[model samples]
Target: MNLVFLYGPPAAGKYTIGRELASLTGLALFHNHLVVDSVAAVFPFGTPAFRRLREQFWMDVFEAACAEDRSLIFTFQPEGSVAPDFADRVRQMVTKAGGTILFVYLTLSHEEQVQRVANADRGKFGKLRSVDLLQSLQADFEACERAMPPPDLTIDTGTTEPSESAHRICALMRDHGLAR
Candidate 1:
């Protein structure tokens, strides 16, 4: 099994690029919003209950996927040092299942990030779609100095097409002797 973690700030194209990567590699896509949106349906976002449920669901899914020997592509938006405990949990699951992990960090220029956030067709998921909300989120993310993790691969989505980015990621995986 192989785990590919795609992480970045909001509007960085993690979902779009992860979709392309999953298509190319035939891996299961486990985007962060899957859990976030689900939990948000009940508990309000940023509440303690919401956070606990979201984290619990995410870990449970990861554990099951790893145990079943399923390759997966997961996406996240880091809030601080990529949540060391969460990363460690994933590592534990993968290790127990004899799987390897590949971390991909997507990035975009500040201007492009804002533009994408304002895109009419963009999926809001559980997030507020207003420009003011987006700006506030971006500002909060930037204020967290230790949010992002060191990545095995980094893609500038503002300058690359999703298909091309997927191709590059797949090539990198192949070079690392990973099947996908």
Candidate 2:
């Protein structure tokens, strides 16, 4: 039950590369939008109810997967300048399950992030599709990155194609004896 946690700002290519990594490594990809979109379907975004529901759903999935001893690739964008307790929680779960965790942070230039956010071809999840919304979120992302702990690996999506990034991640996993 290994956990590969890929996190960064939205449109940083976490989901895009995660899909490729999962396909290559045979791990389940659980992007943040999987829970976000489901909860957003019933409740308005940013409401307390929506927040609680989203967390509950994420925990449920993580718990179930850990219990089953399954490897997973989880992706998310950490919110502004608060140390991510979620990583600690995941560490505890995987440790209790006798598994290891890997952290991969994806990064992109502000310009590239804006471009990706504006591209409609990206999946229609609960993400902010408007350039205005993304511009605002960019500030939050910068703050989050400053406060977050260094990741095991960092990939710059602005310079790397999704497939190449996935390959690099896979290579790192293998080097760390985490390859499945």
Candidate 3:
């Protein structure tokens, strides 16, 4: 199995681009927000219940993805400092499934991310709880380079057209023999 993990700050368009890439490449897309959004509807943000549900959902998804004999695209925003154990769990899961995992980190200008989140139409999965929170989290994500490995590919979509960014990702995947 092939798994592409797309991660970035909120409203960096990981979901938007992940969905489009799934359509174009015939890969299943399990975006980070999809699960969180679903659970957020009922639970208050930052509650222990919400965190538990989120952890369960991601663990299940990773397990399921491991079982499948197909390629997939998953978006994530792992609080870099949360815990190393969780990341280790993900690595072990993928390794056991005989799957290879690739990381794709997308970054854009702060102004652009804020605009996207602020202007976004809230979906059924819920929405960003606070703009200030998103900003702080992103700043933290950026401050620590050791938090996450250098991505397999880093694309800055703030200046490029959305489609162009998608093309760039697909190109990298193809070049690396991760996609058709």
Mind giving the per-residue lDDT tens digits that candidate 2 earns over 1-180? 888889898789888899999999989999888888888889987788887888888888888988888889999888842235766777788889888888889998878887888778665775767889777776777777665556889999999999999999998889879884
**Tens-digit lDDT track for model 3 on 129-159?**
4678786677566654346655888888787
Measured against the true structure, the TM-scores of the candidates, in listed sequence, are 0.89, 0.92, 0.83
Model 2 off-target regions past 4 Å?
A: 80-83
Computed on alpha carbons, the lDDT of every model, listed in order, comes to 0.79, 0.83, 0.74
Query: Could you report the Cα RMSD, in angstroms, for every candidate shown?
Result: 2.2, 1.9, 2.6
Candidate 3 scores a C-alpha RMSD against the true structure in Å of 2.6
What's the best-to-worst order under TM-score?
2, 1, 3
List model 1 lDDT by residue over 1-180, tens digit each. 788888877888888999998888888899898888888889987788888888888888888887788889998887642344676677778877898888888888988887788776666575435678767666667654244446788899999999998988898899888863
State the displacement of the C-alpha of residue 118, model 3, in Å, after optimal TM-score superposition.
1.2
**Candidate 3, poorest ten consecutive residues by summed lDDT:** 120-129
- Judging by TM-score, tell me the better candidate of 1 and 3: 1
